[model samples]
Target: MTTYTLNQENLNAISERVSTPKYNRTQLTTGIVHIGIGGFHRAHEAFYTDQLLHDTSITNWAICGVALLPHDTKIYQTLKAQDGLYTLMVKEFDGSLSKRVIGAITELLFAPEDPSKVIEKIASPEVKIVTLTITEGGYNYNEATGAFDDKNPSILYDIAHPTQPKTVFGYLTQALKLRQQKGLKGITIQSCDNIQGNGDMTKQMLLSYVKLADPALIPWIEQRVAFPNSMVDRITPATTAADIEQLKTEEGIVDAWPVVCEPFKQWVIEDQFSNGRPLWEVVGAQFVKDVEPYEKMKLSLLNAGHSVLGILGALVGYTTIDEAVNDKNIHAFLEHYLKQEVVPTLSDLENVDLEAYIASLLQRFGNVSIKDQIDRICSESSAKFPIFILPTVKANLKLSRQTELAAFVVAAWAIYSLGTNEKDEHLNIKDALKDTLHKQAELASQNHPEYFLEIESVFGNLKTSKPFVDAYVKAYKTITKEGVIIAVQNINLSQINSI
Candidate 1:
């Protein structure tokens, strides 16, 4: 087997080994500065940008990927070493693999290594778009107040040291300030995260941050910057050592940080930009006036469906998402939840077949090649629940619909957070709210399931709703008493009596 490194020079040698960029890599310039350039970005946005780059005319739309956190140092070094080249392998449902070297990222920057450089690059007139995939928790949003978390330590630090900032909001604000001072045009701050009204939320958080840190810039930002709502979907799992070795053995290419995901991909963006934007629509990216319906549909069905399987799968000792989805009981539960409790909450979406979408999601989840970890799906669930599942659950409650399965999803999470499964095995809790959730879960274990719902931010007013509370408690008790497998097999919509 011939060994090769993934880089510009090695492209010719590795053409058959993997899909290399066809165009002149040197001609590509940074027009987009994407923050939080993780697996999903590489798999989705970068993937789309790579396709668009096939057009000889689309030279300036290349990405200068930015990694802000200290933890992202590995990826920064990996991408930097590889000359911004990395392999992306899409695993199809039939077990075939499609491999390509993503070259949309022309450069990589580690903000922690050089904050000033990041701020300067973001302020560059060449960069028309600033994108983020900083995850739901990274926004520092206080859902209760519907504002950016001013009390957060990082936000507070950024507030005090206005110019020498640390957080994402700080970096963005500082850059915008420089751009304004230079009399340069404003840029679009696009969020590709899996949140409802992601663009609106990005605007809200940025504006709030600017208002608190530097009120003078608020007007300029409000007038100039555009935050386009977008709905991005893909199932890129965390990279593992096995994945690394597999790529080397299969493709004969060494990539320090490669991305693997299912073949399915979707991006629906609101066509609002401060400056000229990429012709991404030519490459399968949908630009629309409203992304809210699409957003709701994806969040409610696909995302919430993942959560249900994630929590329940972990409880039932299923490690990967596919394993859980392949299980007859788990698959049935997901199908039922999507068709019964989830779909009713979503209003009509144009050109969308909701039933077919749900069917596809189940099929996607069952794709064995992807190997998306159930633990990964359940990770940051504290942030996930309010954004993904809670909205649909709330909508169902408002409609006087039975949310037994939805409520069960919540109970599954609560039980899973107890730090043990039905078999008394240790369970990993990966949430910012872990300690608090564990304490609440401990109380719920003592036959006080309502205690879990008392976390007002997560459960909201649903904690006080008698019917929801009752359904959740009953579900919690059934899982606790009969074991997860028994509870799962016993789940039936017909058995759920209305409160």
Candidate 2:
């Protein structure tokens, strides 16, 4: 019944069983200040930075994670207790596992506890790169207008009390003000989210927020900060209790917060860091001239593919992504979706093979070892669908491309939002717009088939398009009449017939 607590001291002990940091943790310095540190950041960017620190003599690029929101308290305490040390367990598709203690995160700041400290850290001269992985919903921007929502309570609060800010924009504004006062060099604000033109989006929102909060700092922010667009990929699931137990039983390392992800990881950056960046390219990251194509490709293939499986998979009684992709009908529908609806929307990709990317996505989705929850992919999809799958639907319709599969995906989401499957069983839904969308879906599924599309914020006048309406209505009716499995099978058969 002996177990070792994961910390700086136990690293040497755990090194015998699993990988440990090869760098001296004491000499690490803060060069990158990351906001919204979550499972994705740990599994993706932190993993990459950890490799750089171990393989090279680089110690300045260490990350100081900002625990901003209230929910980040536990992670802050966990990491702080461990002296910013935690294990990263990579589960390969072939059923092999690799565990390593990530030492790249040398410092942790609970922004809620001390807002000024967080602002001071960002203003630090040594830190040149600030990154974010706050998910799709965290950007606090108007989806339809692509502008920052200054009306947000936290944002408003941060506007009034810049030194005691709550939101990311507020914190950035305050920190950048400090930098301007001291005449420090500019920094890069890289967004590692899944949004297309994420850098541009972040820049727009930040500038807009700056205009509202303090118009004077707007010019300084414009000149000082570099928002680099990036494409980050890895199927890192929220660490479950089972994962914690497995690590304890197998590796004998009891980490308070351990991150688990698939062996596959990729990061493509727009080479626009104002100050400087880590030599991440040496450790498998790409610094390209333009990240738009790569961003669109990842959003189209990997993100949308997850949804196609995640939403449909939920309706089909599959709890996990692999379970859904493994189903014969679901797999067929997904493959058709990738090559048919999603591919045509993608163009101008440089040296990137669409077919091979599609194949890799298919394989990645079926990574049973990762066990990425359908709920995880299905969560906050009101924010996700706008970026991930709907564009495919719009593009396909515009080009007269096949939207049968696209329609199926939307129809699947509509039904999935209802909190029940074909069996009328309770399904897990984690959407902020769940109550609203559920009511709309219920009404649409019952009488007014076009009613769900009435949510213009989401469907956005798709109800006005006759072709989309026809396909969506037909697919909606089909799924309700026959189950999800039969509905997808019918669409597949019809698609194959048309060709």
Candidate 3:
């Protein structure tokens, strides 16, 4: 019988002889608690933490992984089974692959299983920095207003009993409360999600929660916590059975929990740690005075670009980004959209070449081995579109020109909401807006494209802008009548020339 867990002997053997040199494990003097332990965290932040672990100078940065949802119990079990040993598969084009075993994680905790355990861990004096990848929706903000929805029952509960509620913000609030009561030094809360101004957003949500729960703690938290903005990128695909088989075949050891990612990775962080931080610069993490421009460039371009391909790929019946990007029409559509429509709106793109970045993004998209799924990318459109795509459209329209590429994205989303693809089959519409999308689709069929814009939470203040509304309506009409292929081919670029 084949074993599922990697025994200590196997782990030691693999660690000692793995092709990629294992970095020295930092001694555990201090703790870095990471919430939302998922594939992306394992593939991205943990990978960086592993690098820091290898650097002997940083001996205090140990990671204690926490999962809030019950489903995460399985992941916790898997990681525990292997003694927190997992292989990270770095995939490249031309069929090149490298596998490395990551071992930076020191312990795992489940929030629902033991909420007090989570609180104690977060409140511990040993824990200095708290990083999160709780996803876009995990913030539990109002989808329509893009603000903290105090009305949410969970939020309400957290307010009433701050320490007991099992939410990320609640956990942070309670932990901060403990810190205040104990006179312990404050910990930095680093947000690793793709939301624009993620750190600030996290702070706002936490502070808002605090205001309703314990107004007295507000000043203390404001004085202590440092919510530093950061920009992180990596293409870590969900693991599949084939990936497991490949690992077993290549390494001669069974790895139940392995992470797969594209070769491309980038992390830009603001150097604003409150308690302390790792010497991540030694492992290629860029620390800067201000990460705003970089964050905007990434959130608006790379993330927005991914959304475009994701929706377009679904329409074209392609599963992975590589499949969609390889199509000449899709590639051209994305290039024109990013270069002509998206890049021009950003006033502070810095010294980076926009054209080169788009080209490199396309190259990354075309990497078949990366296997980034369009469905995965499109999973949370309601949360993603407003943050990633709509901002660019608004910026482009404010310049007094309608961006056809931006319009294309809006239209593509509308078509995607229709509940069927070009193949006339049900397209799995995974989003918080699923129930209402069909209604919106019905409105679109009636040539009322503004119905989609009326989604106040996602479109926000931009829905009232005449230029944006008109252009979006026109694009929606075009897609509804002529379809995505012809609509994309016929976008008028000259309409958005003047600022």
Tell me how far candidate 1 lies from the true structure as C-alpha RMSD in angstroms.
Answer: 1.6
Residue-wise C-alpha lDDT for candidate 3, range 1-499, written one tens digit per residue: 2333464446656664464325444345547899988889988888888877775556678789988877788888888777677888999776788888888787888788788888888889999999999999988787557678888888877777765776787888888888888989988999999988889989998888888888899999888899999999998888999999888876676888789998888899999989888888888899998888888888787888889999988986888888888877777778777877777777665688877887888898888898888889998898998888877877777777656668668877877888888878788888887877767767876867778766777777766787766777887777767766676666633333322
Q: Tell me each candidate's TM-score.
A: 0.98, 0.98, 0.94
Q: Clash pairs of candidate 2?
A: none
| Backbone clash count, each prediction separately | 0, 0, 3
lDDT of 1 at 258: 90
Better of 1 and 3 by lDDT: 1
lDDT of 2 at 346: 85
Residue-pair clash count for candidate 1: 0
Candidates' lDDT values, in order? 0.89, 0.86, 0.81
List candidate 3 stretches off by more than 4 Å: 1-4, 7-9, 16-27, 492-499
lDDT of 2 by residue, 1-499 (tens): 4689998888888888888898998998899999988889988899899999989998899999989899889999999999888889888888988888888899999998998998888888999988998888888976656667777888888878877888888888888889998889998999988999889988988888888878998887888789988899988888999989999999788997899898888999988989988999989999999888888889988998898899888887788899999898889888888887788788888788899988888888888898888888899988888899888887888878767677777877888888987667788889878888899988987767778878776777788888888888888888888989988888788768776
Give RMSD to native, each candidate. Answer: 1.6, 1.2, 2.5
Clashes of 2: 0
lDDT of 1: 0.89
Most lDDT-accurate candidate: 1
Tens-digit lDDT string for candidate 1 (321-353): 999989888888788888888877878598888
